[model samples]
Target: MSAKVSPSPPLYTTFLVYCALQVAFVSFLFSYYDIEVGPIIQPVVKWVIEKAEEIPLVKRTFELLRTLVIGDEVNEENTKTLKKSTPKQKEATVEVHPLDADLSYLPVFSSEQLSFFDGSRPSKDVCLALLGRVYNVQKGHKHYAPGGGYHFFAGRDATRAFVTGDFTEAGLIDDVSGLSHQDILGIQEWSNFYEKEYKLVGLLQGTYYDAEGHLTERMREVIGLIEDAKLWKAAQTKEAEVFPPCNSEWHKDSGGRVWCTTKSGGIHREWAGVPRKLFNPGTKTSRCACVKNFGPPLSNYADVDEEGTRGDLDNPNLREYPGCSPTSNSCKLQED
Candidate 1:
C-alpha cells in the first residue's frame, strides 16, 4: 500500500497561529515583570481596541478578558482610579538662602538662663555673649570650657575685656559706659567675629537688647558712635595715602636715618618723596612722612592753591629736619 500524503494548512491560517503564539509569549513576559504596557504599546493597542469595540462579538470578548484579568470593567472612572493609585517619586526642594539662619524664631535669653550654657555641666554647651548676642561656642570647648584660658568669658557678656586686655573679675563687666568711640568699635568687631565663627542661639536681656529681644537706646547710641568712628578712620586712611609714613631704621652706634621710597608705609606710588616732620595741630608731637616735591598736593586745603607746584611741602603742618637738606629724600638723625 502506498503512504498516505498529508495536506498543508493555508498560509493565512499558519500566519494567524504564529501571531497568536508571539502575543501570548509577550503578554507572559509583561505580566511577570509587572510592566505597564500602556505607554510602550499605546498607539498599536489603542487602534486595535478601537476596531475591536466596533465589532459586538470582539467587544464582548474583550470585556470578558478584562473582567477576568483586572477584576473590574474597563471604563473612564476605573481608569482614573487606577492612575490615582499609581506610585510616583518626589523631588527634593532647595533653599534660596542656605547660609542665612532665620533668627526671629530663636528665644530671648536672660542672663541667668545664659549662664547655664557655660559648659560647667557635662550636658550643657559652651556659650558666650558679645554685645548681648549669645553664641554657641561648643566647638571650641578646649578654649571656652572650665579650666580653659578663656573660661572666664564663657558665662558672661564681657565685651569690655576684649579691648582693655583686663581679664580680672571686676574688669570683665559688659558696661561700656566709659569706653571711647574706638573701644566701642572694637567691641563691634568682636561681635562680627563671633557671628561668623559660631551659631547665634539667642539675645541677652541686659545692656544691648531688652527682654523682648529689641535693641535698647544704649545700643542705638553705640551704633551711632560706631558710624562716626568709621568716618574718622576713613579720613585717617586717606591722609596716610597722601602722606605715606617715612621708612626709618636705627642702630646703637649709628643713631637713626629716615628715608622715602616708592613703596614706603605699604603704600605704593610712582614718586619717592622727601622726608619731613608732620606735626599734629595743638600738639608738639610729630612723625616723619614722605611728601611729594614736584606736583600739586594730594589733598585740598583752604590756604593752599590747587595750581601750586610745591606739593605738601609748603603746608604749615610740615617742617624740614634741622640737619637734612631741604630737597633731599632722606634725613640722618642726630642723637640729642
Candidate 2:
C-alpha cells in the first residue's frame, strides 16, 4: 500500500481547474444564446411607482374638468359681459316711428284675420270662413294678438246648434236650452258664438209676438230703435221681427266696460250682459252700446230703458235687488 503514493492538489490550482471546466461546459451548452454582459441597466420600475402616486391628482383634475363642463359652479358671473370681450361681437339697435296725424287715420283693418264681423246675419259659408280665419289666427299666423279674445258665430239657428256641439265636444254643459242657469253660464265660454260681453247687431221683436199676442207699443219702439242704429234698412220686410241686434256689449265691468260685473245676493248670479252703446254712437270706440228709439215712427221717446232692460222688465225691489221673476216671456226675449 505504501509503494505508490500520489501528491494532493493545491487549493488555488484546484479552484482554477474547476472554473475552467465550468466555463467550457457553459460555452458549449449556451452556444445559441445571445449573451452580452457589460454594465447593469437602470431599472424602469421607479417610473411605475411615480405614476401610481399621481393617480389621486389625475382624478381630482378630472373632477374639476367635469364641474366646469357641466356649469355646476354657484359663482357664475355675468357671462354676457365676459363673452363681449371675446372675438365674437354683438349689435345694438332700436326701431323708430313717426306720429303724423294722417298715419293715425290708417285703416282699422288688419291682415291678421278678424274674429269680429259686421255680418250680423252670417251664412254658413261666412261662418266657415270666419272659423277658419279664427283657427289660423290662433295657430300663429301672426303675433298681433293674444288669442281667445273673441268668438265668431253664424245665425241664431247655427248658434243654437253650436250650443249642443259645445257640450258634445267638451262635455261641460248638459243643457242646450239657454234657460238653465248652468247652460247660460256655459254659453259664456263659447268661442263660436258671442258671449255676454260682446256686441251684436240684428232686428228686434215687433208688436206681433211668436208665443203670445203682440204688444203694440213694444213692436213699434223696437222697429224705431233698429232703424236708428241704421241696421233696419238691411232687413227684408217679410223677415221675421227677430233680426239680430247690432253691437251690444255682452257684459260690463264695474267701470262700465265690456267685462263681467258680479254682485253678492243680487239677481245677476255670476254675470250680466251690458249694452256698450245706448245714447251715442262714438262714445266708446272699443265697445258698442244700445240704441234709443222714438214712438209712432220709431223716435227716442219709446220709453225704452237706457240700461238695456226690456220694455216691460219688472224692476227688482230693494230687498230683491239681484232677483227678478221674468213675468213676460217677451221681456226675456228682448235681451236674447
C-alpha TM-score for every candidate: 0.66, 0.15
The stretch of ten residues in a row with the least summed lDDT in candidate 2 is: 312-321
Candidate 2 lDDT over 159-211, as tens digits, reads: 23344444232332222332333333333335323312222221112211212
| lDDT for position 320 in model 2 | 13
Question: CA lDDT of each candidate?
Answer: 0.78, 0.28
Write model 1 residue lDDT over 106-214, tens digit each, in one string. 6788889988988898998999988777889999999999999899899789989998989998988788877766787788788777877788878888897777777
Model 1 TM-score, all chains together:
0.66
Cα deviation at 84, candidate 1, in Å, is 31
What's the lDDT of the predicted structure labeled candidate 1? 0.78
